[model samples]
Target chain A: MVLALSGAAQTLDSTGRATTLGLLGRIDPRARLIATLLFACVVVASHWIPTLLIALAASCTAMVFAQLPIASTLKRMAAMDSFIIFILILLPFTMPGEAMFTVFGFPASWEGLWRAVEIGLKANAVVLMLMALVGTMEAVTLGHALHHLKVPERLVHLLLFTVRYIEVLYEEHVRLKQAMKARGFKARNSLHTYRSYGYLLGMMLVRAMERSERILDAMKCRGFTGRIPLLGRYEYTKRDTVFAALMGALLMILIGTEIYHAV
Target chain B: MHIVDGALSNPVVVTGAVLAVGGVAYGLKKLPMEKIPAAGVLSAAFFVASLIHVPIGPSSVHLIMNGLAGLILGWAAFPALFVGLLLQAAFFGFGGVTVLGINTVNIALPAVLAYLVCIKGVRSSNLTTATVWGGVCGALSIALTTLFVAISLAMTGEEFIPAAKFVFFAHIPVLVIEGLLSAVAVYFLRLVKPEVLGAFEEVKR
Candidate 1:
């Protein structure tokens, strides 16, 4: 509940945080998909520090290779990262745990505070790992990986179209916002503003839907069969599998450690 | 609310994926060939509804018309909203794949409720009265959807109880917004696309 609404209006499109670490190498769609899979694996494997450490090392290595600048990376965090910070701060005060210190007027609990910190760090790490991969890989290659992963064909096609169209949608949103502003939408900073926003959003949806239907119709007319040749599969030779296996082994070790700590 | 990929536990994700597919499949099987276009358009409407944001507190919000959808499409909105949700997950990450079914059920159930209300209560003679009925049903359905979602999350215990509790609390405004929007939307359709709105004779009309 909190998590969902907290995410609220600012979805991923707003998170244009600059990366501090950049790895060199052009990642195709396949590589990007592989990276996403790998990233998900590492996040789950946080149960084991060995895998996480190995992942952390790979992340740093990838960052250095990518040549990500610190200023830009920090800028990204500063803008869109506040919500994450908000969650972290709130967790300490609200979560049930041992009281650590009284700051100003609030009692900071040790368990809650550290738990929040841990979640925050993990989240940042995941974001960093993704930044390393998303730009490095091509969308096409990743599309192929998804195909092999047995994701639906029509769905992939929809995703391909969606990814392509999102920028347009964002641009449309911007134009609408500007139009609303021009019409004297003084942001009175209240819930009353929600009514106007709601009306505008309703209009926006109708407009966008009309646009999408036209687009779909156009595609169908052009012999679109709801399948896109989005990517070519990269054969995972011994190199890829061995790398994956090594990562898996490391994860087992890390999970072992987390369990030990819990015990 | 949009869920992320790794937010829910694996079990939740797997279960959601299965049910979502199953629901949509079942719904699809029930749709007549002629109803396909209407369903697709309604699905698009459902998807577009989320993109619009209403300003609340410090941020903006948009309509989540799972209620209206269920009102019109009944069980078919299950699949329609499911597909719409899946697209959101991939592109927007509003919610994860695991939580898709949960979210679908949450939103679509109200839509069904609204459908029931439209038939039973919205047939009043007075225009204002009819619209009010629509608005109340719209708002109540959305509130109900949010409540169900919160309850589901608490039942799972994966999400904090506070979060679920806040879902209903937070929807206080959304209810007003959705209720008004549904009435206005239906009103607009009555004026312009009454045929389209009436096309769902199974639910209303």
Candidate 2:
């Protein structure tokens, strides 16, 4: 939620960051879904290195087809999601396995470390697939899909409002935080902070509730009756089906290969 | 956190998907049409709450008030959380479809714990009790949730975080952050809009 919004307003203002993350937060909706599905296949096939590499290769090829900017994509992929990236980097230190090459007095087990890398890459692969795919598409599209998928009316309506207002709340959070800071309010690391946070949250909740009604009123006046309009219909052509099938078959092959190698 | 595609066992993931669907259905069955406005507002509140990242470690983690959810929504927290998790999965992909149940259980643990705190443990005389205990509940909630998830992943024979499930031991500071956040949220709810607390208490009732 933060990524998409900041990417749009702040990052997009800077050509450098925009070009880098553009592949992720700027893909076509249809392509995004396909890529997301393909990555999921890789998740199931993770046991095999050959399969994992093959999936990665396939993702790369798709990235090429998607016209993702190579330099910017790689750079942004690393820079933007640094926390998960850090967690990935930390896995080798924690995992237990046989000896690999030691660096700076750290006994890095190749097995444990490589496994960490695999997990990390798998995590990245999912992100890339989404970035390369739907990271850029409007979330409302997914909400609409949720509606068509027969998600509960209450749930879908809640979801639609949540996503829409998340941005609003983010902005509110920033303005409020700024105000707090400007007023010399500092959040200490202790139990006492709860009162302020609770009170602030309550206020935010009230404001958010009022906004929801206003937004609903505006939307209802404009003919939104708690339902997202089905914007465009997606068709499964034989070729698309064939492609999907081939992808599935390939995933199965990878799984089989991984099991064979593991055994 | 939304678990991504194929992140955990298909059975675990599918089970969560199934239960998440059930949670919403269950909530819907019980939802009074009159509270639709509050429900919508809470949903939006939840989205924004998560957007505001609370500092943890050298980095930050978003606030997910499963405790507050429990305190206010009681069983209804199930549906709210399910929707939030679903969005996180679809949008940011923090947690996955497979780990949904596990995540839900993890988050819901604190929420229900908070419910227990408000009902069985804490005194309603002081809003501070709700705030303080709610914070504790929040901290313990995610801590347990994370512990359960790490253990579950290990049990699944998946190598995601093969280390001891005691990452929550490392997450004490983070959980404290959650406790503080939840307490504040609950405190404010009681102070100005005591009605919200009334509604919340009624849920526990």
Candidate 3:
């Protein structure tokens, strides 16, 4: 389990690789982001199978285009789906409608089951769409894209810095935990355990703040103001335009079908 | 409790996003220029806080630490928690992107509330009072977050009502753990760096 977690951490730390297996990976990050958001909004707006399936297909296509490692991404999706498992178990029993069958004298509703599946599908689709669009880009590049898209400067900087330092803090946490374990700190339902964890967190915070202060001083020494100069200007290419057109067409079909069904 | 995407109905998600935007705006307005680095570091702290799984009952639960965040960051908790949630969703897929707004509101709103409820007490001269109040507010924030998450889920569909209630009850153990964690954290911070208790005040000024 520890090895698996460390491997996951490595993937997170190395999210900036420029290599990709699909054309989507090569598009302007801003455009890819816009398309992803648009697709997600549409996905949320409908519960129709065809529309949801199309959205899923589009997301999968994008992922394939980006040449994302399917197995790892799917593992992540499965992890997120853990909650839906509960929803699936409970929804059938609680939903009031035509009973599918009786379970322990309580009737399971078909409507409830369908709704759960729809939600599950929507969840999976949105996660995949995000993986395809935002997940493929470097964190810094995404921050830059958001900045260029006129997101708040403070928010952009906050995101950039948090991403930059999270791994560092995680390492600090690991070291602290190891030290506690080395000293025979076995976790149990006791005040001693909680307090030990608390001190660990408190110490991490203190260390992080001191580190940030040093970083701030360094930035100031280098003539750093609050605003980080935006990096990596992106120009829309022919491929980007073609991708946008394809996305627009797909969105229209999905929306048109949704409206048609509503009528 | 992070509300994943597609779990909530459209109206709830939209309302959550709108409210979160308001909270973030207010947080930004209160954020001092010099405090930017502190905010970032704390945001990272809150994010990493989730990785430490404390043994609770048959399983362990991670600390959300929104209460400690609230006590230290005040209104700045809004943007601080939002950034953490965003990165978690993007990098780890802990939560979905579309539901970011509601998830932000669910988690950070309670942090803001915890700030209001315990900030004065945490700054008290009496160490015992500060620690007790820190624990109270820490647990209260988790309770509030659970409530918010429950409401968000229940609003999506009636079937979720039982699940919603279960969520709250399920977190009762977490509340106790969080309270203890916050109390000790407060004690430590008071001894080592009392100024952190006043960091938000400096930012507001």
Candidate 2 per-residue lDDT over residues A1-263, each given as its tens digit:
24353212223234322232443333334534654665565565576556677666665665565455567666655553453444445556656678676778776677766665566556556655554454444556555655655656666666665666667776776777777788776675444444566566767776765675686677668886545555545555555555566656766776777777888
Q: lDDT tens digits, residues B1-205, model 3?
A: 6666677888998999999999999998888767788789888888889877998878888789899998888899999999888776766667887799999999999998988988889889999999999899899999999999999988988789999998999889899889989999998998998778647665334
**Local distance difference test scores for all models:** 0.55, 0.59, 0.83
| Candidate 2 Cα outliers beyond 4 Å, as residue runs | A1-35, A38-42, A63-98, A101-109, A186-195, A213-263, B1-21, B32-37, B55-61, B96-101, B116-123, B157-162, B198-205
**TM-score for all models, in order of appearance:** 0.66, 0.75, 0.93
Q: After superposition, how far is residue B205 of candidate 1 from its true place, in Å?
A: 18
**Which residue runs of candidate 3 sit more than 4 Å off their true CA positions?**
A1-22, B203-205
Q: What is the lDDT of residue B14 in candidate 3?
A: 93
- Show the lowest summed lDDT stretch of 10 residues, model 1 chain B: B89-98
Quick one: best TM-score, which candidate?
A: 3
Cα lDDT tens digits for candidate 1, A1-263: 01111111222233532122222333333444455455655564364334455555665555555554445544543433453454446556655667887778777777666655454444445544454444333333334556777865544443344444444555666677789899888755554454565455445545544665587677678876544454454565654555556545655555666677668
> Which has the better DockQ: candidate 1, or candidate 3?
3
Better of 2 and 3 by TM-score: 3
Interface RMSD of each: 6.2, 4.0, 2.2
Query: Candidate 3 chain A: worst 10 consecutive residues by lDDT?
Result: A1-10
Evaluated against the true chain A, what TM-score does chain A of model 3 have?
0.89
Q: What is every candidate's alpha-carbon RMSD to the true fold? A: 7.3, 5.7, 2.8
